[model samples]
Target: MRFPWVDYVVSGEADLLIGPLCWDILNRGRDIPPADLPFGVFGPAHREAGYPAASTRDLVPRAVIENMGDLPLPDFSDYFAELNASLYADRIHAGLPMEFSRGCWWGERSHCTFCGLNGGSMTYRQKPARQAAEEMIEMSARYGSSRIEAVDNILATDYLKKALPRLTALPEKLAIFFEVKANLKRHEVEKLAAAGVRWIQPGIESLDTRVLKLMRKGTSSAHNVQLLKWCRQNGVRVSWSLLWGFPGESDAWYAEMAPLLPLLHHLQPGPAVRLRYQRYSPYHYTAEKHGLKLRPAVSYRYVYPLSERDLADQVYYFEDSEDDDVGGHFAAGSANRRPGLSAVAKGIDAWLKAWYEPKLSMLSMRDSGDEIIVEDTRAIAVEREHRVRGLAREILLAADEGSPETRLREQLSGTNVMQAEIEAAIADMIARKLIVRLDARLVGLALWHPYTPIPPMTAFPGGYFDRRAAPLGTSRE
Candidate 1:
């Protein structure tokens, strides 16, 4: 029951507290020892130029809490307020940002060949669905904004099912964003569309099945394609996370993946596809346990030699051919370029600013001036969208009523939505936090029921009853 962070906030022992602000406020002014409060700084400068008060050396202790500096510092209240104000300003100019969870779940199972998280040793368990929704609501309130980007490694399927009802009950204006595993089931997709989930980013690490298997991904390329198709059918917008440069991966694998370009085109395109290079980091415990060969941490001075294939592959994506050189591994065109280091640095800076200091972009539908147009040319289109939304709402509402049959029926009925239209609607709803789809079940439902008073919407917002009511007297024969 006793929360240490709350104690620190209450006892006037902390100046700046990060992580979940609600927990800090809830336990404020408790009797506890003053502790070091961790803060996440933004700006390309912070990551590139580095913080003057702290270096990478000082980062670990501040983050760990126990190792906080004992020296007197600035007034806690003013410092925190300024920091928050700065973050708020950033959001206003950048984009609404939200972090659902951190670290990878699979870290506990098998360390991916190219993991960077303390060799994948430090894994953080996911917050419960209810707790996550509460935090999301609080964050939305703080920003006076409904849009959120969930910067989680992967949004777990069960969490989606459990949290859907609570999320659906939130004020019907908040929109949520998050990423998830690609192999979600059909019913889960329907549930998500109903709940009001808006933006979905799936980690499609590779298109090569062999490469996927080597990465220990528990999904197949076929599953990835299917998930994309489902998103298109149900209305989910996808921002794909791709990885390149896995060891032993051949040019043939890249060639095999080339065919997937058209598939990417079929999915809704927002930001240009983010392609990342695989950086190998050996975690002490995890690598040893997995029988992975541990590489000694290299100093900044050491440079690895790249083969002809590496050079050729790197050039394929590099926009400027002129940048290719022997020392070009850390070249300007490399996707791995650090923030504030090159032209790509601008993109990173923009991302951090948009993420931390939320900015509304055209890509975000809430900021659009035009009313959303629903063109139901086909009989199935209208019926499918309405049915899916209705069933999703039933399942969501059933959570409160505690009717198992209603929940099951709601799920079974919703899955009947036409594949293409359902995918499109689900994509749109997922981006808005109206619903969340995971593994073919209505895992989590946001409170965007079609009924009036929006029924005390809970999780996030952006629910509207403007949708054309119930397929206008049955479809034309």
Candidate 2:
């Protein structure tokens, strides 16, 4: 019953260490010596009998359990049974959390400068498509649920082409949630929706192109916008965040983008937050080289009440302060140096406020007879009722939940529909914001809203994961 962040400060004297941080160390100890191997301690042990802290950068060989099918299926029946009868009943069934993959493929290349989720395990591996489909089906049947929450660091590319088709063939639809990169095409998004992936957490950290580049997110502002557009088109709910405070970023970018915020009103809005430094992130390991001055967050000082050295050993997060004198970092400037940042923040707040409004969204459509009527109320508006017919109407309905141009054309086969008509419909739809085109694919610009009303939760607020009241310093044999 020890908290890793707090207990690790004193638990260094313990006889054994476990969990992911020490997983490779224990497995490879017999095969490779610690010094010559890619895994193990980078410094001296904390105490006379204790093991040194595990290295997060080690590229040691992972155990055979890399294939998720070999693992035991988790049981959530007991928890669900209690939850159903309790006051905390009103909640979204986002489904049971599971993993189909391990580590991040991108991290092995240019890792997002602020992320450390993969830690030492940068090698990517996934359960086979058939195995993954079978596991989800089994879990749904066992738990009487039709949803799965995949906890993969990032959705493996193979899953898009392989696993999706297998899942689509399942007898029942399972609402699967995923974390995806922002550079996906419209067809890929439609495939995910067709395969029962109802939601995604696309890591679109910033919309400012320069800030994105500074963070090495390997994506552009336009690319992020397209992803959001496609997600809405595919009836996929996207949960993302807007982050700022990069070491080498300039405030000018935010200023330039603020006025354009209204144009994005048709899409989902994410909260704007300051960036946080985490353990094993590029920012944490190479702060000095990036012109960043790192220190523990102020809250940690007040919460832990421990010496800085002990806090440093256990803490996995940091606060960055740029030196004014540093050349790459921002220097003291006119008071208006951050006007653009504030403007952008204000725009985001307004966008979020509009997002929750009862009658508004990026786009909402209704199929009416032979003509498709569109209400474009995004940043730029078409106040009049925009309409289209024939091939355009057919394409809109087919792509209401997103479809590739090729898929749409294939669906129109045997009909008198021609390629020129399809292409013209796509062009008109894009101009009216009735649909979004990405990577030569098109998705209808409509957000999916659930029709059923959800039950209210009880007044009491609690969850099983509330570890704040758990007693510490307990030992287990």
Candidate 3:
């Protein structure tokens, strides 16, 4: 009987005990009998002799490598040498996945209901900023690959002030991937671009505030849209999923959000998917509490012909008893139940089709000294020229990317643009689709160039972090 490797111990087939648990038991000299070895560990264990047992959770913490310079370089040259050179066509260099952190910082607080990505642990730990940056440079140099994917669940906010400056100083601009919160500031997005982080998986799960609150994502719909706009302006490509499915959600929420989708045609679009029940998520843990009765998904029956009890131990996906759990019977790719849910799904589909067909649209603005000339070419029929001077020009220029109403007032500190004029201008622009008022912040939708191309959309696209290497002006080949 083994101790911690309880699967082997449970089968009553192992002759020796190993792993941390066994070592802890032997080291402590505990009085656990051999017959009752696998009590706490998962699954049923059979009894046998000649094996040891332990029940200690004394694992060492992850070490912070202060100077990664001292560590041995990972050897991948031999591995890369075996690959065909033809496979490397049209690429700057091969890519590699790397990690600088573990668990998730946000999961420690309000864990998203449908997320199981963090497993049992939510203790956020990260490498020191300088060590992390240097290691990235070293690894990329050693492997001769410029693409580095940081598989952290969420980027540590401290990295912006700490690691990003050091990363910007690297001679070769390496392509870096990160998972970020959607409520990033405009300056933060700019810094991310400067630091060579060109790709991100910001969790913009839903564009409806009610759905967001139900999932406990701690971000609003406006905030997610703001991120998409900033990502476009700062040249960062966002890879995200739009998921719908939550207990106690109304159909009205989706219907209201659908009409606003066309206004964001210039931004990147992602596929709409149903909320799935995962094993380690809050939804799975408290399914019954939330009026959800779960059975192992249909695929599990084919994989395991055993009893339901046995299958429950192996399967991760589950089918809830309530068919109308999300948006009143929205299932898989089809949404036939409620009109509102169907409208929402259809809106997302249209957005993706527009993006795929390259139905490019933009409202461009230029500061020609005396006045700001605006050209509107959005999907809306009014694709014409408009000129703004004086206070309107000041406000639009100040809020070229985005600004809070309070900050707009602060920026116009010296100008005589009265509060009434600014308010009227903002309202007019929003009505004209030249600018969008998201919550308390106003963002100008116009780009510097007309027909600004939406970056190639992919569920997962690969590229280097250097801005020059981005698929900005080029088509997906």
* TM-score top scorer: 3
The alpha-carbon RMSD values of the candidates against the true structure, listed in the order shown, are 16.5, 9.9, 6.9
The estimated TM-scores of all candidates read: 0.44, 0.68, 0.76
Per residue, candidate 3 scores C-alpha lDDT tens digits across 322-400 of 6645333355555556678788878888887776664555557788887878876566625478888887787677666
- Candidate 1, after superposition: displacement of residue 103 in Å? 2.8
The digit string of per-residue lDDT tens for model 1 on 1-477 reads 112222222211133344354464456533222332234322222333343343332232223222212212222354335645773433221224554455567645655545544321235445667666676667666655566667667785566768777777665744666667766775676566566664566766655567777667777665665565456556565566555434345555555544333223323333323322222232222444434342222221143245444432222122212223222233445534332223323332343344322221111111112232222222112121222344334343332222344345555557685555444544554443323333333222221222111111122223222133332213211
lDDT of 2 by residue, 315-369 (tens): 7787765433222222235226577777888888898878767655445555568
In what order do the candidates fall by TM-score, top score first? 3, 2, 1
Tell me how candidate 1 scores on lDDT: 0.43
Task: Name model 1 segments beyond 4 Å from true.
Answer: 1-96, 118-121, 171-173, 269-477
Q: How many clashes in each structure?
A: 80, 2, 3
By TM-score, how accurate is candidate 3? 0.76
- By lDDT, is 1 or 3 better? 3
